[model samples]
Target: MKEICIVEFTSNLGLKEPQTGKEPGVNRLPDWLWKHNLHKSINPKNIIRVDPPKYSNIKDPETNILNADSLVTYSREQAYLINNLLSANKFPFVLGGDCSILLGVAMALKQKGNYGLFYLDGHTDFMDISLSETGGVGGMAASIVTGNGHEKLTNILNLSPYIKEENLWCIGNREYDDEYENEIRKSSATYISLQELRKQGIANCTKKFLSEIQNKNLDGFWLHIDVDVLNDEIMPCVDSRTPDGLTYDEFNELTSYLFQSQKLSGLEITILDPDLDKTGEYTKDFVNNLTSTFNKHFNN
Candidate 1:
């Protein structure tokens, strides 16, 4: 049986403030899930938290990014914690503050050796900073990890391209930016649209990813789930809400297949805003679906 380690990243450094002095609710993701019984559901072997620096709404002048300095600092701290857990063979199930947490995990994995990434998010998150409409680093996380951003964040701990393009797979994207999607298409990372994933059948799509990773003989792969990848009618508590995405049934089937892999490293769930789920109804549904899925197949 796989020993799971529950990790909580308490940072929203990647997101833009909704208003002056107003922070994003994604930072509360771990707390919300815990209250909804995600901890009880997993009963993980370990629980860890990486707290963030004080919230700053000011964009960094040097990098032209929001909270650039703190992001670099927090990522380093997270890498240390993740490294310890990996050394002990604990599978990390990370509850993220935002997509930026990927940097820390990527740093930890890079220290070990080459690994593949299965990025499941509603948006590609692969655009350059100059082209960013919102100026949020969270939206550019995919690109940064693949060595497509400012040197400071992308080259954390003297490592660049934290995850190589050839070993990366970007899936479940429905939101589009002409420049962003075009850049991803041109990169080495495999891009699987939400429509394409559904059309190809979850099992087949997942199988292709697993086979490709194994074929490359990679160390293992990390799975990232940005909840906005789910259909908006059911999953509306997200920073950027896109209309169409995978249904709960489709998501369950996909996870069931992916989780069965022994080569899997760990998984992180990001961008589910607890503030929007006022009644906790949607949060409850998300938790229950996730709990059921984990019970049925997590590193099984």
Candidate 2:
């Protein structure tokens, strides 16, 4: 039996949109999922909470990433906690406040050894601060992990480039700005757009991806799933929404392959804003899907 470690990251400071006297509500996610008995179903060994440092409006002079200093501090703390869990041989199920949490996850794994990244999101998240209109760290997460962003973020824990570009694989991305797309083309990281995923079929695409990862002989890999990857009609709680994305069935199939691959070192779910989940319908549905998927794959 796999011992799951539930890690809650509560921080919305990485959001580009300034707080208008209201919170992003992403911080409420861990508790909300727990209300649905997420941990009970997974039989987690421990639940760890990594609280964010006090947020500040001040952007870093060099990085131009909003709340840069606070994000770094929070990420460091998260890395420490995750590393300890890894050392204990626990599989971390990280519930994130935003996509920026990927930085900390990568940092934790980097300290142990090399790892690949499986980024499943609506957007590529490859923009640097210079190319980013809002300069949110969330938008630059992939770039940071691949050593394409500011040193403050990419060089966390003095480990430059948390994950290798060749080892990074992105899928389920349906939305992309011109600059972001161009950057991805230039980078060594492999990107399979939503259109390509559809053309090849989810099962085939995923099998091929996993085969490549296996062939590379990577130590392990982290999976980052931003909820925005779901169709906007079904998942509208994110701050950024694209028109169309993976349906519930498609997402389940994709994750099923990933979990069964047994190559996943850790997993993180991000960008579900409770503020937009007014009637709690979206949250309930998301929880149901997540639990079903996990149970189908890892609950044995």
- Estimate every model's Cα lDDT from 0 to 1: 0.88, 0.84
* Highest lDDT model number: 1
198: Cα error in model 2, Å = 0.4
**What's each prediction's TM-score?**
0.97, 0.96
Write model 2 residue lDDT over 1-300, tens digit each, in one string. 568989999878778654655656787788877876777776777888888986655577887878888888888988898888888878999998888898888888888888989999998888767777777888878988888877888887788788999888888888755666887878899888899899989998888878887898887888999999999999998999889999999999999988876778889999998778877888788888887888788734
Q: Name model 2 segments beyond 4 Å from true.
A: none
lDDT of 2: 0.84
Number of backbone-clashing residue pairs for each candidate, in the order shown: 0, 0
Strongest candidate by TM-score: 1
